[model samples]
Target: MNNPEEKEITFVMPFGPQHPASGHFNAMITCAGENVVDLKAYPGYLHRGFEKLMEYRTHVQNTMLSDRVCILDPFSNEMAYVHAAEISSGVEAPERAKYIRAIMAELGRILSHLTWIGIMSSALGLESGAKIAWGDREKIIRLNEVITGGRLYPCYFMPGGVRDDITGDMAGEISRVLDTLEDKGKLYDDFVFFNTTFTTRTNGIGVINAEDAVALGATGPTLRATGMGSDVRKDEPYDAYPCVDLEIVTMEKGDAYSRSMVRRGEIAASISLIRQLLQKMPAGDFKVKWPMTKKVPPGETYFCCEAARGELCFHMVSDGTDKPYRVKIRGPSFSLALAVFPYLSRGVQIADIPAIYWSLDPCPADMDR
Candidate 1:
């Protein structure tokens, strides 16, 4: 019943804007019989003009705004922002405050990984794993709430140091949480890492070599998974990182499994850093006293740190005023989600899309910001 002159066209599907796997991001996928032929990533679903907005707010006020840059790892944003401001203003945080910053940054890493594990598990249809990961993640949230007075956005790290000191009770609580998470690591391996189904889905999928990853602007686990030991912390030590013993985690395969492994290893590394920080923490003032109307000297400076996703930097310019004249945030997710995701999606099966996407751990908010 077909006409001789009829022509057939390929089907193009919209992956998301509201899809669970897409996480408020969208991708235009062209499939050739269940195999992806092409993909185009569409970000900016959630944009708040943070760069422009930062200019209007004072440097201290902008700390709160930085917390919103990436809800999953707000501390990094705060760290980078404050560090840039501190450099411009020629302010040095106390030794104890530097230790506190390192400790909090590591905690943020663990928190971010926990959230990624839960969400990534759900994307792969492992609801039980998701629940367990989220439940355990809550403990850290409660711990941070007690230490920094904010569950998600601590807003604790300022230009010169942290907002307050980590007293005996707070340190003890952090130690307790670290112990609990360390024990839970074995459970994660059994449930998610060693689970046969997970391995089957992720083992050799979405492969990207180290050279290709770097060319595509990949960072964090996405770059490290390809046998690259490059890490902002190790390469350019900041805060108390110079004083602490730290190691960069890397893998050879450069597949989804490798990426997951890098993050897994990093969780353990973060835990170790926290322990070291606690043992070596010095007793001193927490933060430098500054007035609310403090103004940064006219200068341009850049500061970067090892965020959960990757190298997060803030390039700030001051016009000898309380407010920054210009601010730019280089979020890793911007490249990972928009550039790397599409590159990895080609030739992948429709079923493997979610696995590959979540493996990169792309935060849409970070991309849009």
Candidate 2:
């Protein structure tokens, strides 16, 4: 029974505060019936006062703190903080240590990306893709745990270099894992990357132009997917990045598929970097002994590194105290999450919002940090 005098009303629908696809983030999306008209990102709850907490910890103690800021890509946070600390203290890591650090960071990238692939696929309803990605993720995690003491947040990185050294047959073990990863790459290429359903859902979806992406301060793969070749590794080399050769990966589509492809290409590229590192690694001390209680020189430094998600930077100010003066974390997801509104403008359907949101790959921990 329809009433002639009745009216249909359109209102804003909340997308999260508890979305299983991504983590803890919310979106208030206004829709005109089934078509999306506006989106407001409400990201937080993961802050935990990470920066303020870092100030109270000692120089070495904060490395563990940095890992919690962005759990998915712990090495990048470790690298950035270590770099800043080294610069402030006038210490340089040994060549062998640098190579090991780079190798580990690349491995961390692969691990994070695999997890991301599974999440993204699941968000798009591609169960097979998610299953394959998640299954392969275990192989990398096993290799990581064997090297670093911890399975997830390794805490293997120290101020001068790494906490420990890779000696004897460990390099060989790493190579064997790399070989296995290459074989699995073929499996993913066939089943996931080239799948028609994936292409249909991703290609041309959630498009971001190069100009807009730059203006919005998008970094890492988000900017690169728009055909920007900007990379912290290639642009400004730090750690072992100067020693190893890297080819920046980019895609012009500026869509979900392009971002996913950039990460996939980097996974392959990271494997090559790892092999190069093992071959070129010099024999030397793993770390320069620095007591955890030592205070850094009175100075400020900004260190940025390309993580699996994007450019992660840490701005640290040390007033010659064992405890830091002030620390600010610049996460890649902040700007990307804000830009969600522009991409969600009227043309997109209400059902497609999650797909588009997942495309930006915002990490609530990163954003809130």
Candidate 1's residue-wise lDDT over 280-310, tens digit each? 9999899997666698889898888989999
Best by TM-score: 1
lDDT to native, each model: 0.91, 0.84
Clashes of each: 0, 0
Angstrom error at residue 77, model 2: 0.4
lDDT of 2 by residue, 1-369 (tens): 789896665789888787684589887878778877777777776769889999999979999988887777888889999998899889998888899999999998998888888888888888888899888788777777888878778898999989988976878888998898888887887777888877888888888888988887888888899999999999888878888889899999898899889988989999999998888999979899889798788999998998887889999999998888999989888887866444544578877776777777778888887
lDDT, candidate 2, at 315: 94
